[model samples]
Target: MSGTGDDFKWFGEGFDGFPKRLPEDVVEYIIFIINSKLSAIQTRERLQGFQRALATLEKKFLKEYIWQRESIRMDLVCDNRRWFLRGTTNYGDSVADEWLIVYFLRELSQEFPDAWIRIYDTDGEFLLIEAANAIPSWLTPEVAENRVWINNHHLCVIPVSDHDNPKSLAIEEALSIINDVPTKLQHLPKIEQEAFYRLKSFPSAISENQHHATLPIPRKLAYILRSNPSYIAPAVEAFYLRDPISLRLLQPEKSRTQLNFPPESFVSVSVRFTKVLYAQLLGQQWVPPGPYGEALAKLISKESGVPSVSREKAEIGIKVTAGFEMLAQHKLYADKKATREIQLLLEDIEAGDEALPSDDEIARWPKREDNEGWLDIDFVEFEKELAGKGAGSTTRGFGDKNAQDNLRKMVERFNKFIEDEDAGLDGAKGLGLDPMDIDNDSEAPPVGWEDPEDSDDSDDNEDDDEQADKEFEEYERTFEKFLTLSSAEKSALLDDARELAQVEEAEKEEDEEIKKLSEMMEAELFSHGALNLGAKKNSGVKPVMGDGEGRGKAKLEEFLEEVDDNDVEYLDEDYNLAENMLQAFKGQAGMAGPAGNLMSMMGICFPPDADTDEEFKNKNKDPVNNK
Candidate 1:
């Protein structure tokens, strides 16, 4: 009887006057019965009544009913064409709910083909029979873990702890359930299956009569719909189709921990300014050249103002264009001046002079001339004489024809004298005088004269020679007196005369050798194909003459003058001893020591050591231990 009453209430009066509008009270009471009942027929009949009421209100609230009507129309289109629903109960036969599900599926499939849907029975088991043609049980398990429904199809069931309210299952949540299914089932009619599952699983109609009894929309989804009202539920469902969990998780968190510190705008400004300054400096726009360049140029100009193009540009134009070059030149000049002053100061200190310029003062002073005026008058006169003569005449010319004639005569005379000496030596040899014996003679031979007719002049020359013979005899007697003495005495007398002769001969020979060598070297050096080895005239220094036997004596005299008193005394003592020994050799015949020995002792006494000390200290002290 209870079963009959339940069936009668479900099939007989539930969907009575189905296509027409139900009374508001009847619709509300029907929604209440649908919510309380577990039977599919009762739920279906109540949903049919809600649909009729929605249609009746459609014309009156056309704009509001457009989305609802369109949803119903899409569901009907899908359900009516199915074979299983050909002759079902009136609400079961209605295809509006199915068509609405198909519409949502089409929208979800466009965005994400991998999306799917699931349906659950009132007991939360796979509702295979109820959704047999629309969605299979196999698609439901894919999202069984993150499902919207739990133990039962009742609206009281919720999957996640946080989403316990059935009101949370809004259009977005329904779309999410479809998207969360396995990717393999996404190509199925996901949106249609999702809508079908939502109706079968929840089994409640959304109508004005049951408006108060309907589950509340999820706060997140409701906010989204309110914010983006232009987008319909199917459009929002499309977003979830691609990524269900992530899209749902995008809901704003209530307890967000965002940072609140103000951004530092000055950092970028400071960096930009620093970069600009660095670029300017690197580009050489800001930094100028130092003072050394100009200082050096000024010094050069002051010291030697030879007007030159480069110098003018360095001094004037360079200052205008690249001024630092001039500054660098100035610094260089200052450094040079400072260096020279330091050297001069050292020299002064060595000389015991107290007054000397400081380095700073020297650096500040103007450039001075390096060369001192030391003119060679003879050279100047010679140059003047050369200038006076015409270029051609100055060359090695036959000086005034008469002078050439006189030179030729002089050459002939010199040649005749040489010939006469040869003849005299041959005659002496023929007269039994040994040629070697001639070299033994203390005096050199007198100059011989040439006569054209020696036979005719012999008698006249004999008469003149007779008087000369008497004077010569007397001179021979005097000379023979010194020769008769012991060899020691004779050598002593000869040495006195030789010393006097040597002095005069040395002076003459030194002068002649210097002049000859200078002329020879000058000619060789200046000649083509030879090295131009000559002192630079600009240096204003004379060329040093080569040391010769007699020429070296002057250098010795200078050295002797420069020697300290102690060295002079030592030399004088040794030389006096040598003189005494020489005198003793004269007194005692053939008793002289080696002359070389005396010379060696003199050399030791007159050592080349120069006394550097202010006092006449022992300059010749042994280096190992100077006592």
Candidate 2:
């Protein structure tokens, strides 16, 4: 790979052998992987696909693909506001390739110049699939409105991840922790391990028994190293295998190129280096060789206080800032063309050629004059007021204990959302003017609020359960019991039904005679002898009966009316023809063959009113096609 020109400046990582002129689909696929919109299985498959794509990436074309793909990523990092339009759930070949971005800019520059760009991707996968292939018009019902209004000063950047992705990188950073055998991650110092955990898997716990716990779970995991040194090596090894997020620390390798942050994710840098440094100090292979290893050595030496430097003055480690701090540090203002100016400033910083503005200068930037101060709204108080849980707590439907509990939970959930986004909200600083005071109602749902899609899903499942139970109860025996029956037992049931039906048939002397006569006549009339004599066989057309008429009586009357007795030279011929016609045309009043078969089977298997006196009697003498 050749070195890139000085014009392209990404010194830290991933721009070393940049590509040029590649397929847009490749870029889109990279974006999809970054979005982490796939399942554990899907993400694994996707990562494998990416690895294969990279492996097969014609060495000659590597430069263009890397450069173009990175360009899209850099543009996103440069201007957070453009992310207002998210990647839609349908993420096909739509990761907004260079040309796509250029086209979007062209569209905006020509028309809807003020439009905040939208870039949502789909399964194209959705924000979270409530079910298959359904992308919500809006991630949140409140956010669902077609329009998204982002103030120039405080554009929010929502971080997304593939919690289930299992791919890992085997770069210098990951490999340095071990030589060959057991892999000595145990010596990777507590301080170093703490830094990594805080960045990669912070705010998570194996189990949280305490309510309102401020998820310092990664810190807790870090604490384990200090508490028990022997466990560190095994834990780190297990973490690497179990947690996909740990891959963020490693360098860009085939099949693993998505970095977890901008140029300034200190925790990530610190953690990756800690492992390599631990091995370097121990005189191991130190496989990953790069400027990053040198930077880490310098950072550690500075922290440990060099030969002449005082330990007190040396930095302990890199400190990470909140999202709001990042916004303020950039010094963005809601002034005209602010996004472009901010991008330029960031680019300059990346180039190491621009000096940051002084504190006084940054204070002069726009401070969200029209924005709502997130702290002012109280969702819980509002819920209590609406439900009257306290003052008139017992006055209304709140009397139901379950109702009160539900309302309380809803309130807590809404409030918890505010707490989570507090960092972003801080960046949305008020210009000292009250937004609610200016307008009675704001369209926005409380910050970080999500639609109750889960609850709806549970309700749907419950409805299905109730319907299944109702149908199940209609059966004489449970399905399990039916399944347990032997073939002989099942056949014996048929024998009993057939015998009982035969007895009933014998009792129906008046109708049995007609039935037998019909059966005999059909055989004789359709015989080869009768056919050669030019005698007409039964037409097979069943006649319809008038209201309330018995099927047997109706069929007999129709046969008598249609009979050509004069044409039948013999009395026997006339009788046979009429009987055969009536019997052959005896139909189930309105059922197709399959339905009639099913009904008959069902009746025999699980007779209704089993002990009823008329058990063997026909219920539908004249059948109707129920379907």
Instruction: For each candidate in the order shown, give its overall lDDT on alpha carbons.
Output: 0.32, 0.31
RMSD of each predicted structure: 60.7, 30.3
TM-score of model 1 vs. true structure: 0.12
Deviating ranges (above 4 Å) for candidate 1? 1-41, 63-71, 74-146, 149-157, 160-627
Candidate 2 residue runs with Cα over 4 Å from true position: 1-151, 154-627
Model 2 lDDT per residue over 171-190, tens place: 22222222232122222223
Query: Lowest-scoring 10 consecutive residues by lDDT in candidate 1?
Result: 264-273
Best by TM-score: 2
- Number of the top lDDT candidate: 1
**By TM-score, how accurate is candidate 2?**
0.16
lDDT of 1 by residue, 1-627 (tens): 001221123355575422222222110010112132235464455444434544544444333221311232212112322111101111121233333333332333333222222322222223322233334333343233223321111211223333342222332454344335322123334333433343432212222111100111222222222232222222212221323332222222421322111110100000001111112222231211233243334434643232232332233222222211111122232343322443344455458674333335433533322111111123323333334332233343333222233343344444544555434744422233445756666687887886766777888888889989999999988866754577579658877998999999999999999899777644533342123223232332111111332344466456557778778566554344433333332333433233323334555222222222222246545678875
lDDT of 2: 0.31
- Give the true-structure RMSD of model 2: 30.3
